[model samples]
Target: MKQTPERILLPVSPVFIAVSLFVAFLLNLQPWGHWVGVPDFVALVLVFWGIHQPRRVGIGIAFCMGLLMDVNDATLLGENALAYTLLSYFAITLHRRVLWFPLKKQVWYILFLLLSSQLVQMLVQFIISQRTSSWFYLLDSCIGALLWPVVTAILLAPQRRSVNTDLDSSL
Candidate 1:
């Protein structure tokens, strides 16, 4: 049996986490965001950080970001906030268990988390508007789930250590 080497990751910087979340927020603000299957970038990033750095990026940050999203999208004030807070709570709760799985297996867990968040958002929308959205709205969760591995890689890049550490160089 060939064992895959596990790379040691450095501590994630708070600045990097903040920047990634900001970028996701910007992505969500794009015109195409209104389209079905566009994926909720903010939700994705929030879950990622919530799981990886629960201590630093907890429900409070999620709530604040969701509020910002709510304001930006001009939706009900607390809709996104509630959804994101719950998403963060679950991610933090499952972080330890999810970390034990391989990337492929992790996708399922992430999909579930994203879906739950979407469901919460949809429910809120339904309650406020008294109308149900098309099933296509769920596509956003599916797309976000599919992007899990890619997002993980991109976000973790900064914390990855060099494959070969040079002993000769002393700074």
Candidate 2:
């Protein structure tokens, strides 16, 4: 028989969530080039928080973050906001169910979510620009999904519960 060590989760604070989002936003600022199809860390963070802390991080936060992303990218304003809001709605809607799955499986679902948001974004850009876009833009969704495990491990690290195994005798 195999023994799996049991662990508990510690309560998380809102500040931690805020700081992580801010850091993700900063990471999003890095210029990954228009051709690399680099993942959007901000989107990844928003989805993670949307799934894990919906009450604290809702569509409003996602919208605000998306707006910031819009300003940062210098693209059509509200493009990212719309897409991110849609993503937030989907993530929040399925958050409870998604929570039940293990991290590996969650990646597949998150990938779908990421792809949907990217599709929305691509549509918006297509409508505004009215030009055929290179398929590389969709690469961000795949990249984001690929990086989901790393993001999960980093975010959940702080919440891991440890059993000291030594009982305290203090009354």
Candidate 3:
């Protein structure tokens, strides 16, 4: 009797992509702070996916995802795209280090990544729209940073279980 291992799909499959996009749309559409803001849920999901499945999701997808967000939010074209692309690229570069770190450490790194992405987006908005930056610009990053742990916990739970199982089998 041949016992084959169950085929587990990559966590970041098309379904995840669609759900992420939908969440992004909701963030853009949701009436939050008098329609002035909402958390960048898509960015959060993308960061998780990037760290978890860097081999499948890459810079191009990140850029396109940002562009879609821009179009949906009616922001200057390429602003979100640039931010997302840069974030994704950096995440990919640091993926190995992030994976090795403990959850708390990874949350800190992801917070930085989220802030960096927002900084890039803010810079673009300032340059293109010549809009005055407000303190409120930092709010999304703060919320995202706070949510980082929760998001990471949810995303990594299954993987951790699988990894533990593998370790047990090897031992």
Candidate 4:
């Protein structure tokens, strides 16, 4: 029997996830002061994938990616996980509308999503540290949101062709 499209894509490409995570690791490693770290590449990539392919990129993967980010950044253990999981959940839930939006509009939506994750992180940090974070904490969202098109185009180009074929067979 032929495998359904869903079956073929269900496991997803672990290699892709690994590549994304590795890129995120490198971005996080860039030497920077407390003010201007690289944008959270992992979160953006995960959001892109989650919204574009919810069946493949779900909460577990987001949680794992977040944990990896936490290890790389040495933030509180669950901080990134909490943020990523929540973000992915939201993305997947809204995938229908999000997938249909134009790239620029998608960037705006992603900005909101990214900000929500950061706000959660801030709240958790505040509860622990009893202080507010710097304005720069919000800067990464702007950079990430702005770079959404470049990032999505580069990452999804190959998948785009395949996605059409998959969609035809699945629907």
Q: Which is the better candidate, 2 or 4, if ranked by lDDT? A: 2
How does each model score on TM-score? 0.95, 0.90, 0.77, 0.80
Q: What are the candidates' C-alpha RMSDs?
A: 1.7, 2.5, 7.2, 7.6
Pairs in clash, predicted candidate 3? none
Candidate 1: deviation at residue 33, Å? Answer: 1.3
* lDDT, candidates in the order shown: 0.94, 0.87, 0.75, 0.80
lDDT of 1: 0.94
lDDT of 3 by residue, 1-171 (tens): 555454354454566555665665576656562232456887887787788778777888888888888887788888889999988988888889997766667877887898899888878888877876787876777777678788776665543424344655766
Q: Is candidate 1 or candidate 3 better by TM-score?
A: 1
Better of 1 and 2 by TM-score: 1
For model 1, residues 1-171, the per-residue Cα lDDT tens digits are 566899999999889998999999999999998899899999999999988899999999999999999999899999999999999999999999999999889999999999999899889999999878888989999999999999999999999999869887875
Candidate 3 vs. true structure, TM-score: 0.77
Candidate with maximal lDDT: 1
169: Cα error in model 3, Å: 17
* lDDT rank order: 1, 2, 4, 3
Residues 55-148 of candidate 4 have per-residue lDDT tens digits of 8789998998888878877888999899999999998988889866677788888989989998999998999888888878898888889999
Question: lDDT per residue, candidate 2, 2-66, as tens digits?
Answer: 55644677877888999999999888887653445788888899999999888889999999999
Q: What is the descending TM-score order?
A: 1, 2, 4, 3
Per-prediction tally of clashes: 0, 0, 0, 0
